[model samples]
Target: MSAFTMAASAVGVKVTTTAKRASAKRATAKASSSAFSARKASLNGVSLAAFAAPSVAASKSSQIRALRSAVFAAAKADRSKADDPDAGKGQRVMIIGGDGYCGWATALHLSNRGYEVCIVDNLCRRGMDDSLGFNSLTPIRGIHERVRKWKEVSGKDIELFIGDVCDYEFLSATFKKFEPTAAVHFGEQRSAPYSMMDRTKAVFTQTNNVMGNINLMYAIKEFAPDCHLIKLGTMGEYGTPNIDIEEGYLTVEHNGRTDTLPYPKQGNSFYHLSKCHDSTNMIFCTKAWQMRTTDLNQGVVYGVATEETMMDPALINRLDYDAVFGTALNRFCIQAAVGHPMTVYGKGGQTRGFLDIRDTVRCIQIACDNPADKGEMRIYNQFTEQFSVNELAALITEAGKKIGLDPQVINVPNPRTEMEEHYYNAKNSKLQDLGLEPHLMSDALMDSLLKIIIEYKDRVDKSLILPGVNWTESASVGQQLEKAEKVKA
Candidate 1:
């Protein structure tokens, strides 16, 4: 009989198996019925980023195919403690959008912890955001330049790829070439306002986000079936829910029949709707193909930099404060830089889960090491705290005033479509159980981000702060406001 059957027959005793095939790790939950919680007290940190992912310079496309195949075959074999990311030996990791904000930081953070990392992107943001005449407030260097800087600082080379995930051939080729043991995907169009601005933006979101993700799954199965995939999904995918968010799944009783299913996603805008579509597609693939995947329904992430990027100004990734891609905290901090009042949309009572970039790295690392079983899919709500937009704006105003910026708070006519105020509560316990001690969005972290903006205040383009992306509700109002936001290219 299988070990699973043995555990089932043990009667009131749970048998857990690890890569080591050691004793089960469990604790009886506080439930009256069949409830069990599993915990791993210690997981070795992945120690591969600097030397692992970028094993060697890419040879010409015509060569090194055999070497790449060997590496991939090794990755697909049943894993052991030696390959565990948590073992302080870090996995060979690939971050699809490693040049983007969260992706860059995550790549570096894991590298510092000893994981080998490779970044893949088509620089699509440059294409999309440039057309809108907005630039990420801080200048972003190309991937080659970034790899050079990383090597100079940490004596490591983060493999770089100028490939598009939307292209199945490129994606499949990269997976075969790198043979990464794990991948963290954060490449997606992520702007609610922009997606609602026009049909083109909406179509772009749907086409690019879904296709890119689907391609990744296909490539993983074809090239490296054992690699763990930790994909970044937005909390906005859940929209403004009335109940506490469960960790990726929920149980409901319908007609006295109870079943657990993926939580209902209530997306508000086109961008968010695409993320919801992504989760649905990922779930279908994971269950059908027995692929290992972790969907992190993360909330809006704040804070300026992580432990990795602060190493040097040259190492910093894109920091967008304009309306197009700017998140709330980033935008508010930028407004303070230009002496502009914090822009409050509508009544500004919409609440969202928020996380610091530092904790974001921790969360990602934890998920990578402790993957779901082959036939089991797990989801985690990735957020630490919740705050309304108004509350956050007030905090920025207060923080800016202390720095002598005297930043004001202005109630702007919300150009795009969304609920101004809504309920949002999500559960994020599974990650904690996996040993994630979260880093809260402390005011100190806020100040750190603000001070970075302070140093770069001269580079602040106040005009880009609001691109006036409008929705059906206020399309005409947005036309007039759009003229006010573009200062220059």
Candidate 2:
């Protein structure tokens, strides 16, 4: 053969080899895509086994991301078909703790806004009231009655699932079936006093709060990684920091290096500690699984009425004024109604963030309408105003006087082991920027809330108004105080 003929032959072989490799790459990509689709089909109860599952020839991270994306897409399609025709127009959201104080109100709020809502709860908080021999100052209807009343009042439907989130199988099934566009999580134990009541209560709180959230994160990853998880974290997670608290992260400069990290947490109670743990888990998951999350570090929620909740009497939300579940203002207002003096703990200088219930619902709506990007963990300080315990008591006293309740403010020995004085300047601009017109604490709101309290005054148990749980090692301090008050009487 001539030299030119040999070179031409070599060039032809090289071209054929290059073409073959390109063909192989295309085949691999196709196989990987098909295997992912088949897995998704199987998950959604579609039998697509005829397509052989092939090992995805991609990086480990790429394969995982692809699998998650496919699973979520299939789940979303399945959920869309199961929902009402109108549900497709609006985003479908699931509330994991949909039966509690905030959860119930949020369901009604979102439903009124035309979003499809599914509420999941095991009624553990209600059970806690029974276990602690405390009841809401206001009469609360059962979940079934509440849902029925919501439907009757607004002509909107809210799907309810009665189950524990700690049950992974149950949660997984719910996620698969609902395929929510977002999840508003409020399903954990939320009381600091209750958690510190006893060793058993402490263990239950930690396990219930942490494990349930972990299970939720896993279920989201496996079923719907794209679902924006809007967790109801407490401002208590940041405690009473001396420095101004950032939204959810802080920037540090050390050794000529600057890095941004999650804000330093200093939760004052076991309940708050559990929330910090959840935040850590979420941050890890956001990085490891590329999951999207929004942690709304909410302050103490006050007030009762919302647009949807006020539609009917039966649709009213639960109002707790006991030491365990009741907030400062709620308990104070109820106290004034029953002619009991406002029991201010310590010097009552403990200041914290606050928001009206009406605003809380609004904030959630804003968060839902605007979702976080994949692998992004968004945090919003979710309160409109701030007040010290003394200021709240004074406000309640002034309102009580207006209603002829003759409320008096009295200072009592502090039951819990928190600071009476601390700096709390947490930035809460994120939610406001999202167009949250805050309902500031005003006398009109106070008067309205007092009227309801007065109407339910007959049902108020004065005995349950006092603290039952002490944060210190000696749990009997609260009991001792109760006995002393009884003797003084």
Candidate 3:
């Protein structure tokens, strides 16, 4: 203070020690004000000079406080924008394999929520029905017809692209043309029994699921690096572990060391193995290329109708009750409706996760609304509830009795090799935490399924309802040789 006073005296301004100290404080405040002005300009696009310039007569403390408040407000606004899923309205979403069960409903749901939706499918799921000599228990229209009907009913258009995801050229072209904000991939061979049928089918399943996913990753990298990849993985990838299943990873402490690693995978079939491969590749893409991905390890999806799928008869979704494609609950309800015994495999103790088709579409929307961060590979176990085969049969039996129908339960040899009885608990809190309200299984849902089945009862192929593909049997020698020759060629 004495030095400040001496300097002031030399400058021809007489000042007391207190006056000198006060003068120095004013200069420091002025400097801080200038710095804050610059920071405020940079923090948000607004310049304090244009709107809330500090008055010359204002106290230094008040000025500083005002500037700090403005900066904090701006930063908070930015975070709110980033986290709001509503910010994604009117953005584009490309649904690969949108003609299929989960994809179809999700496409409509997103479109209804104000998204521009387009579907990319090769009509292979329909082709599979032809090749198998069976059709869905409920008749479904062609993709073109379905989309047209959707437009008529909802007054919203969904663009259709007819091509296979395995074809890179087609996939790349679709990506370039659409330039999607997100891509929901349901383009995979999804049947475990079908994949286990023979060598040819197994090879095709691996090639289609694994190669198609790889192609999608590369296409997204090239065309839309920022696009979120929402892939439909399977709970079958985890199989039936003795311990409770974690979402996608596990933290381990081994030999006095600890690290978090991917949960150990024990896929039960070739189809499930293909899903495991997809998960590995997805993790690599995120780490190497800073790509964003969300792998939904989904449970067995039940029910046939979502809000969108029920809008019109032409917009009806497929109800598969065949052993190859149908789920346990769906098959049970159909069996109950048709006066056939509910087939429970191996003591009816095999348990797995389950969810409604309505929940399936909603989960997809939730994933899209809350995308993963860049270089982040998010994993969610997408299911609402868990039930054993025996439990499903029992529930259906009760529902069937209330509707004046006789339902019987019969235990058959398990076709697939798995734990007949074991501990089954999986964490499904992530989806619910992200605002997913699930539709739990109930008698009303079962009754609705029975009514639909009764309407289309004649379409049910009783012959296809029984298990055919046995996991214990190996592929024929001719089939293996043929596959080998094809590989050589």
Candidate 4:
């Protein structure tokens, strides 16, 4: 007799060898009633009823415990499949700000990887461009056209939902209909310069970012509580500090005590401040409601080409170089292409973390593949390299020189009040351990980016590059608006 049979015999239970083995099989098959029925129907050509009858003398509690063990074994099998690439073959993913820069790229990346992707966007980014009197230097295709092009290129259909995340009704309805397994949230005002442009923008940023996140959390809680949330946080949430910045926490030793807390945030702009607020609410959600979230505190993403975007011209991602939405390195690439000077602000010693756009999508994929546990909030500082403003300008200038553009580098007065030079170091080993091979900034990469910019240089509106949005309190808002109007005209 096996150990199981011996144990049952020792329990003062009348058990034959056949019945003992059948009881074990029944317990393992309890995950499904049909499986249990099939296993219990026979045992070594004998009916299970022979042993399961009340006269068999097995306790009801023992039978119950055996069934519980089967259920747990089945659950463990299901969880083991979560890490497989084929596991997400039929799972749905919803991209909240799918029409914008990061969202569009991520949508394509996920879609190509065999996920059912649905994109929800209000197109507020484009609307903001209209209000600010500038546009992406490269003409971005309309949503319909972009989606159509993607389908043509890859034969993968991506569903589009035109709506605002702030509208709770719309979000709830979306959550009900799609029932996504994962959500990538990029649906908020993202530009610091735009948020600080005026009081109205500042308020709008807070309302839109904070409320949208809240509604999303509630929608998930009510409709798809098990869905993993991959929120796009910003590195700007933690401003330059004297000490090395950890992923999302700092361990401090005080008088006879030690505590680990969320790293202190000192966002210089209202947009980043809104992100800080979002972080707090997410932490609360995980603690209070057992929600799962992975907040990617990403750095300034540069470069425009991705594996999908480079496949076809129509699928090109948005490339912005204006004062409001553009990053420093992207703006530098466009300036070099258009024969404009690489505008370095102040002493140009301001340093920031950056990653190529390709890595951005890859990082999101890694996040989805490795989900956070329920009641856990995982944070990853998403960047590969760091460079100062002057260093980036020099790199762009040199790349331009090699291509015969010979780009001019000029020092411009800093428009925003920020640290021109600061001590900065941040740890980012978490994502690296999860299999993210970063695409570093290289001359060949710059050469490829410049080539694309040169193709669109003819569409460059030099005047629109510098909108007169002053950050200093002493600067007259009226004068700034008037100057912007003149430039627009």
Quote each prediction's TM-score.
0.79, 0.79, 0.80, 0.80
Error (Å) of candidate 1 at residue 174 is 0.7
- Highest lDDT against the true fold, candidate: 3
**Candidate 1, run of 10 with poorest lDDT:** 23-32
- The local distance difference test score of model 2 is 0.79
Where does candidate 3 stray beyond 4 Å? 1-88, 477-489
Q: What pairs collide in candidate 2?
A: none
Q: Please give, for residues 321-415, the per-residue lDDT of candidate 2 as tens digits.
A: 99889988888988888878889999899999999998888778767755676788999999999899999988988878887878888888887
Model 1 clash number = 17
Shift in Å, residue 278, candidate 4: 0.5
| Residue-pair clashes per candidate | 17, 0, 0, 0
Report the lDDT of model 1 for residue 321.
86
Q: After TM-score superposition, what is the CA distance of residue 345 in candidate 4 from its true location, in Å?
A: 0.9
Off by over 4 Å in 4: 1-87, 474-489
Order the candidates by TM-score, highest first — what do you get? 3, 4, 2, 1
Deviation in Å, model 3, residue 59 alpha carbon: 51
lDDT of 4 by residue, 1-489 (tens): 242233223333222332342233233223333442454343312334534676856666665566546544543443344323333354467999999999999998777766668999999898988877888877789998999998777666789989998999999998877777778999999999888877778889999999999999999888877777889999999998888989998899989899999999989888999999999999999889898799999999988899788788888888889877888887888888887788888889998889998889888877776667789999999999989999999898888889899788888889888899998898898876555667999999999899988988888889766534557742246766776799999
